[model samples]
Structure formats: C-alpha cells, structure tokens
Target: MIFGKKKFLAAVGDFEKAAGARDGEAAERAFAQLYQAAEKAGDAEFREAGPRLAALLPSVPQGPRAAVAVVTGACVERGADPSACAPAIFAGARAGFEAAADFCARWAETGGGELPEPDDELTDEIIGRTGEEPAIGWFTLPQWEMACVAMLGHRSVRRESAGTAELLALAERVTEASGHEFKCLTYALRVLDDEPLVVLHRETGTGYVLRMTGIGDNFQLHTLLAGVLIGGQHVPGDAPSAQEVAVCRDAPGQVPTQGSFNLAGPDGAWIFNEGTPSDIPVVDGARLLVLDPPPYRRGWPAGRFFPGMPGDLVLDRVLDEAEAAEWFAKVQPAKG
Candidate 1:
C-alpha cells in the first residue's frame, strides 16, 4: 500500500469530527483527504475497513452516513468485495441514508458500474423496490386515488442522483390514490428564481404564460397535477415540450392585450399579462387555457418586479382533480 493504515485512520478521524460537527466545508475537505487515503491504501486495506465502516453507520447522523456511503461506492468501484459488510450497509440504507441505497441500486442494476456485483441479497433488495409498492416513502397520498392506474413514465435515470428516489416514491403514492386508469410523466427541470414554471402554452392563434409564485407549496401542487394526468395513477414526468411547462385550457376573451392584468389581487391572485402569440398549433377540443399568449420577457436585474414579467408571474387559478382530468383528456389527445 502507498499509504499506511495509520494515515488512513487519521483521515477517517478528521472526517468523522468534521461531519459530526456539521461543518460542511471542513467535512468536504476532510472527505477529500479520506478519499485519497482510501484510494492509495489499496484494495486489501479497503476491504478490511469495509465492515468497520458499516458498523459506524447506525451511530452517525445523515451527513456522516452519506460520506461513508461515498467511501463504500469508491470501494466497489475499485473491485473490493463488500460481502462482509453488505448486510449492515443495507440495513442502514433501508433505515434512511438514501445515498447509500442508491449507490447499491445503481451498482446492482448496472452490474457494479465498471466493476463487478458486490453481494446477492443487496442486489435483490435494491431491484425489489422498483417492482413492489409500500417501499420507503411510498404512502404520502391515500391508496384509493391510484387503484386503477396502469402505466408510469419518468426520466430513464438511476437512483444515484439526488431527489430521484424520493420523487419516484412520491409517484408511487400518488398513483395508488388515483383510482382510475392513469398514465403519469414526471421529470426534473431547471427551476427559475426558486420557482417552477407552471404554465406556458402557445398556439398559432392564442396562448398564455403563468408562473408559480413560490406561494403555498407549489411543488406539491406540481406533483398533484402529474398524478391527475393519466387518471391520477402514474409518475408525472417533466413538463412536456419545454422546461416543465404546464398546458392548461385557454380561457377565451379573458386574454388581456399587451399589458399586465392581475387576474387575482394580493392573496391567491393570478397576475396575468398578454404577449406575442406563439406559432404552435392549438389542440382541437381543448379548453382555451389562454387566448393570447404572452411574449418572452427576460426579467432580471430590475424588470422582474413589474407585472406580466416572468419574474412577477404568480398562480391565477388551480384546477381540482375533476377539472384537471377533463382538461388533460382533451389536450392529451391533441398536439399543441
């Protein structure tokens, strides 16, 4: 080994101290050193330490658990056999530590990345979550809503990425509560100004733009809409066409011309403004989500505060499950 076991242990101590204290920067620096030491210590040394690291999992907080998980992933990447430590790691992972479980799942599904599978039971449990319901965090929504669901479509991604696992779990819950033949498409996208884009429908003749005003759990609202689609049964993928944009039935004659209109005021209000119409085709048989779409205005530096500007847009209307289902059914069949 290029590094002594004493040096590796010292690095581990520093990392644990930093992580325990919740000093993010210090923990990051310490982990870098720890990772380097582990790398240089060779496969035999890492294999020997694996069980010890697993034993530490239950006693540490989330931060240290994640750090230890990273180390495990590194060991697997370098061809270390983790069988001796797999049981403890899996138990801790199921208890919480998403990062650890995801790494294990990714390795199993992909055949241990550039290496080989670490253990059999770990692989089976990881794969089981995908096929079975009632997995971790899979019961936020009531089961009745999703009784009749059939399909779920999401981004083809591994669980290793942050938030992916939770998102899938939420999808499972929502699907269970849908209670109808449903299809869901859920995907992540760029968040603008700490908010998700709620509506951006543009048709050759008319369309509109609506933005969520960081008001009242819009994130939850976003997820609900996904479940509402496909009969409220499957995973909702990212916004179709552009960046997580929603397509609502356009409200005819309600379109304001060239200026900003406050569809609602102060509390629970929709600040609407009309802009250039898009050349996109209108889906036949769909409600008029917007009559005349707004023009794209980059609101930053100063313009964001003005009404009708992208930065100033807020929620104007919310559709219940019935409304959402009706609107989605009409639009779902047509191209817009």
Candidate 2:
C-alpha cells in the first residue's frame, strides 16, 4: 500500500470538519477513508500519524461514541502508544452520554483488545497529572482507587481532590473503604453561611489568606473523631467511642505549614495536630483534639496492613505559615 502524506492530511482535515459539524454519516465516511490511508501508510508514516490522530481525540463533537472507539482501536492496532491516547480517550468517553466503565467495555468490544491496566507507577503519572483540564468524570477504575488508597499522602492525589468535588468524594470513599486515614475529610467542611474564614499563620512573616466559601453545617465533634479513628473498619456491631480524645479548647489561631495535620497522639492513636499537645496551656475553647488509637483488632483484619501515609493518611498541601492558618480557618472554623 502506498502512503501519501498529502492525502492523509487531507483525510484528517475532512474528518475533523465532519466531526465538528456533527455529521455522523459524513464523519464516519471520512473516518473510514482516514483509517484506510493510515493502514496503508508505512511504519514511520504511521508513527507520525498516531499523535495527530490521538490529538483529535477527546473528540470535540459528541456525535458517535462508537466512532471514537473505532478510531482509538485503529490507532492501537496500528502500533500507536496507548498511554499517549488513553487519557484523552477515557476522558472523551465519559464526557459523552455513557459512564466511563461502560465506555471501557465498549472499547473492548470495538477494538477486540483490552485497555492497558495502569499500575501504581503509571497511575501516579496519569491520575490528575497537571496541565490539562479536569476530565468530566469520577474515578471508576479500581486500580485508580487502590492507588489513591496506597498513595494518599501524595501531592498529586491531594491537589487533584482539594478543589474538585468528584475527586474529593472519591478520595473519601477510598479512604473509608480501605480503613485508611481520612486525609480529605476536612475539605468537606463547609462554612456556616457562605462566609470565608481568615486566620493568621504564626510561622511565617508573610501573610496570605485561604478562602473557603460554602453553606452547610459542620460535622459533630464525636462524628468527626470516629471517622478519623475507625474509618470504615470497626467491629460488626460495636460502636467506637470518641471520648478518649484530649480536647484543647483554646488554641492560638495558628496552623502548621502543611494544610492539615496527622500525628501520633499520646496514646498512640493518630490525632489532628492543632497545636503542641503536651505544652498547650488550658484555653477556654476546644480547638485541638488528641484522640486515643483504636483498640487492637477485635473483628478487623489481622494481617499486616501496608501503611501508606502516617496510619495511611493523605498528604496535605504545603503552605506558608500564614497560608496554612488561612486555609485551616476557612475549612475548619467549625472546630471553634
């Protein structure tokens, strides 16, 4: 088969035009011609063609999901790298009228091939990698969810969920289901009446304010403590107590440079680091709560669980002292 660069480019142009116009029949015809040209092209020509084709993805027009699947399948079959295109493909599939999992299933049917399974390393690179617009979908792949559970303290995972509601929810679910530390639970805290909370950070000379604007009531102290202590893992019928926690009612309006805190309590349970527990003078308001660790496994798994973060906690953003204070002030003013 003789490959003509001019003809291939022309076919691509025509297909893009047809797709943009939402002319399914015309798009399909143009795509067929485009694929045929690609098929006839030599390896070098195909390699160059691959990215051009993939770049067309995350298709602009939501005309035919199957057609997008066919284009992707052709690229993979013809030796195009899946990673180069998978993110866009998956993003486009979900933005369409189908769930991402269902689109993946459709991809298999159309391509007669399986999607690449992203491992921990690759998942790190792909999930919420910066620079691109947020994909219009939630995390559906179990591999993605598990990776989040394992790398809850990772910066990419935290940044991805901090402002995005869907990803934030996924982060919460992953932490709860795996009995890992709930790192993103604080992001769920809403301001009492859509007012932003501003607090000064004690550590830095420069001052910046963190802003959180939402209207909802904060969770109860006991409920919040239970979520942190036991997560989704506890005895079948036994409820855990939030009483073993030491409360510091009056703490200075300062926070660590990290947006959130996870440290070992005096009793060895992980606790929220509001201030120095040992030396904090008795204040009138309860600002910090140092909780006792859960009891030895009664009905929980007995195997040695891999600790991802400190007790499988997620990493918070590193902020300037003032920034941290403002951040905490916005999302966690309910502590006051």
Candidate 3:
C-alpha cells in the first residue's frame, strides 16, 4: 500500500509524458490511479501529490457548455428569444468560468492543499447564480491552462456588472475551498466593484508614498502600481536640464538611463516600470511619471518641484528630497 518516493516519481514522469502527448484520456486515468494510490499510502509525500494531481487534470469548458444550455432552456422555459438571451447568458457564464480559473490558479501556485469535501451550500450558490451545477471539472486543468481561461473570461466580463456577479459567485467557491487563505477572492471582490481610481502620493523623504484609490477594489490596479514602484523611481519633467546631461555624459557608455524597476509582490518578484533615457537632474536616468489627471494641490516650498495636487490630503506621506535621492540610488542599476 506504500508507494515509495521512487515509485511516485516514476508515476509523475508517466503522467507528464501522457500530458505532453496530449492524451487527456490517458492523463486522466493516470491521475485518478495516482490519487487512489496516494490516498491509500497515507503519507505526507503522497498527500502532497493530491494537489498536483488535481492541477494536472484537464478543465471542462464550463462557460461555453453552460451558455449553450442556458440559451436552449431559456427559449423553452421563458418562451423568450434565444437570440436575446445569448449575449447576457454567455457573458455571465464566461465571467464565472474566468473567475473560477483565476482563483484556482492562485491556489495551485501558492500550494493548493487537499481538495476540500464537497460543500453543498457553496455548490448551491454557484448553481443558483449560473442556473447550473458548478462541476469539479475545472480543477482538472493545470494552473496555466486555468489562467488562460480566466484571462479570456476577464476580458469578456470587463465593464459588465453581470460578469461581476458571475465572478462573485466563483469567489464564493474559492472562499469555501481555500478557507479564504488565498487573496484571489479578495482580488475578485475588488474587480467586481470596478470603481474609479484616485492616485495617492506621499513624500517619503526618499520617495513619494504612492497609493491609489480605485485600487482598493481592483487587483489589476494594485498589480500595476506595485510593478511601477518596484521597478524603479521616475522623475517627471518637460525638459532635461544641463546637470542631467552632465550625469549621463560623464558616465560615458553607461547610458545612465532607461531601465526597469524590480519589486516583489504577494506572489513573487516582478518588474514595475520601464524607464527612459533623459538629461534632467530630476528626470535624468529617472522613469517618466505620468499622472492621468496631474496633481492639483500646492503647498511645498516655492520653486520645489511639486507635481500633482500640492498640500492635498491625498498623499499618505512625502519623503524628504535627500531621502528620496538615496532610495533612488539604491534601486538604480549597479555599474559594471
């Protein structure tokens, strides 16, 4: 009953081969057998394989499948034109599928634990929202496969509240399965709100305390902001100054500008911003800062470069120039 480590590895290789061959049927059979073996073995290693097994399986095209059923059923049940319901029904199902995929992928990457027992309450909620059973078929696909599905679904649902609702329904399942340990649900909830954003900046003495409003509900916005900040420091300006030109000119062959900011997130490290070459002291070697609606407040010392609203309460904190300069230096690329 004990499938040793070597045996497990062999089985995993077999599964991979099957997957690579695009033999979904064979892969499915291998995974099911592995699941049973792991369960019977009852060891930590075997237990760990459970999550991987679930991830390796194929995903069912739930959205399209659900859409077909809804359109057909609507015509008979409500005596409505299938054509009229096509768009709305398809949109809802698509959103649900996408949200589900995103949630699942996050789970897999962060260590998807054992699949939880079926929760009637959660399943009922999904069915109620989509008018069909939320099957476990989606969990069969690999994380990347699920991610692609979620991405397409996200595009379809963008700006549509019905899509938001469907995503919310999927969030409920994610919450139930993961016991809310993952941030996917949180991200999904934010996406659903689809609120307008207000960027927040505070002087950190070394750099500005960059925060945004609309992001409280948008996961993508948070991702975007984080990427920009971690990637590098940007000093916005209309023209390059002589001093900036000197810095780059002195460095000769260094280029002294145009680069990316690297930062870590809840997931891992990523590039935030890609900077451009420049010749302005503040803007030289600095990433360009573009405010959608330029800052509208002013209260700092006269002649001090104050972009955006000055004296505005929107900024969380403002770093002193010296500190900002120091921080920027640290993140700057090291000379060869």
Candidate 4:
C-alpha cells in the first residue's frame, strides 16, 4: 500500500530513533526497507521522502565550518590526523559533485529536453541562503555542485587552506543571495564558481623552491591525488564522454617517457618515468600520455595515466569498495 506523508514521516521517525539509540545496523536495515517500499510505491507523495530520508541519517553537516568539523571527527575516529584526511575528503566531495553533474546531463539527454529552469521554490531557497547566485553556465551546473560538496566535506576536516575558507564563504553567500531554485547540483556549481583559486607556495630556505599549484584541471586527477593522500581509493570513474575521448586522441605530441611527471602534494613528492617505470606522478595524474613516440609522432598508443606522490601507492587503497564499507561502518550508528 502507498504511504501518505504521515506514514513516511513516522517510518523515518522510527529509523531516526533507532539511529539515535546507536543501532546503526538496525537503522540502516529500516532505512533500506523504507526506501524500497517508497520506490515500489512510486508515487509523488512517496518521492519527496527521498531527501527526508537523507536528512534523517547523520549528514555531513550543512554549511562550511560545520562540514569541516564532521570530517575532522571522522578522521579522528579512524586514527588518522584531520589534516591527512582533509584533502582526500575534499577530493571525494568534488568527485561526488562531478557525478551529480554527469547524472544531470544524462538525465537531460535521456529525457530529451532542454535544461529545466529552476523553479521558484529552488530560487527562493538560494536567495534566502546566499546573498547572490554564483554565475554558472547552464551546462555546467550539475558538475559544479557535485564538486563543491566534495570540496566542502574536505574543508570540514582540515581547518587550514585559505582556499577552502574562501570557497565556503562564497557558498554561504550564494546560498543567501540567490532566488534561483536550489537544485543540489546547481547549489554545488554556484559554490565552485564562487571559490577562489588555491595557490600552493613552497618555501625554500632562501625564498620558495617551487611554486606548487593548487588543484589543477582534470577533476579525476584531483580525485586520485586526494585518495592517495588520504590513503584511500580513488572514486570510480564515470563513463567517458565522447568529447573526452576525442580530446585525448586529437591532442598534441606522443606521451613523453612514462616517468616525466611530478606527482606529489603536501604529503610528499615522487618522480616517475620510463626507466623507473613508476606510476604517474601527481603532476601528470589523470593525463593522457603518449608513450613510445616523441612529440608529433605519427601514431603511438596513448595511455591514460593517473600520477600521484610516489611510494608504492596502490590504486586499491582508495577504490576498494570494502574499504569504503569499513569507513562507513565505523561512522554509522552501531547495529541493533
């Protein structure tokens, strides 16, 4: 039978009670049952329950400062320093934002419609939350929002990084100012657009050794770097876009010798190349490298590489589902 809002809310209340009691496993099971029931019912009344369900769970706190606090708590629980996990969490949030965007794009395409304009409800929410809407292109809203949340989660753990602070401020401002309908994707996009670029300065005894750049393009690379730095697996890849493939194929010279990139971050740096044949460094992480041919070579097999701070960094660390489950298990309320 279909549930009314009252029934749904009551179910959520029951789950919340279970969660509060630290019966995490039981709560999760209850939540799963509700979710499946709602899905099976498939009515508009039940549909609104989705976000409510999320709200009942231990959310990654809303707002900037709160978000950082949550991440810090998680890191502390894991026997890892908050600083160590900050960047990884940030990267993970960014990956999530990107995933949301990809989902939006696919949704639009599959639905065979132009991007839907934000409804008054969403708009009013944004305006109430942020003073103004961050300027975001229509096509990029979903990706932008997904990335913003991931970054926000990261900032919640690591208190340093002026860039994180600035972005958070911007997110708040946007939330307060805009009357645009508040789609999570759109909200995230606005946050990213409002975020200031982060510049990493290396101080050598004399001056600064190398002017290390902040997170670069390729969201995937940032995702990889964050995973390794946090000692976790990288986020799973989304289906490659035709544009991405074309960009890879048509772009310039052959991929230089394997180890030409520098893949390091606040944690440390490492060198990778053909002779050493080490994994790609953070500098060249997520880059399409052409191997076996010099610049402008006729035809050489191009390889997709993800570089990182070298030292036997294994892909399994971040990408493993089991690890994610473990992490979740620790944070989630205890099983009933």
- The weakest ten consecutive residues by lDDT in model 1 span 147-156
Rank order (by lDDT, best first)? 2, 1, 3, 4
For model 3, the local distance difference test gives 0.34
Give each model's whole-structure lDDT.
0.34, 0.35, 0.34, 0.31
Candidate 4 lands at a TM-score of 0.23
The runs of at least 3 residues in candidate 4 whose Cα sits more than 4 Å from the true structure, single-residue gaps closed, are 5-10, 21-28, 37-294, 297-336
Off by over 4 Å in 3: 1-156, 177-196, 204-336
Per-residue lDDT of 320 in model 2: 66
lDDT tens digits, residue span 125-174, model 4 = 33232222221222233333443343333323323533455444433443
Model 1, residue 253: distance off in Å is 61
Candidate 1, after superposition: displacement of residue 183 in Å?
Answer: 18
TM-score of each: 0.27, 0.27, 0.26, 0.23
How does residue 18 of candidate 2 score in lDDT? Answer: 83
Give, for candidate 3, the lowest lDDT window spanning 10 residues.
304-313
Candidate 4 Cα lDDT to native: 0.31
- Candidate 2: where is the Cα deviation over 4 Å? 1-6, 21-23, 60-63, 76-84, 95-336
> Could you tell me how far off, in angstroms, the CA of residue 112 lies in candidate 3 after the best superposition?
17
- In terms of lDDT, the poorest run of 10 residues in model 2 is 244-253
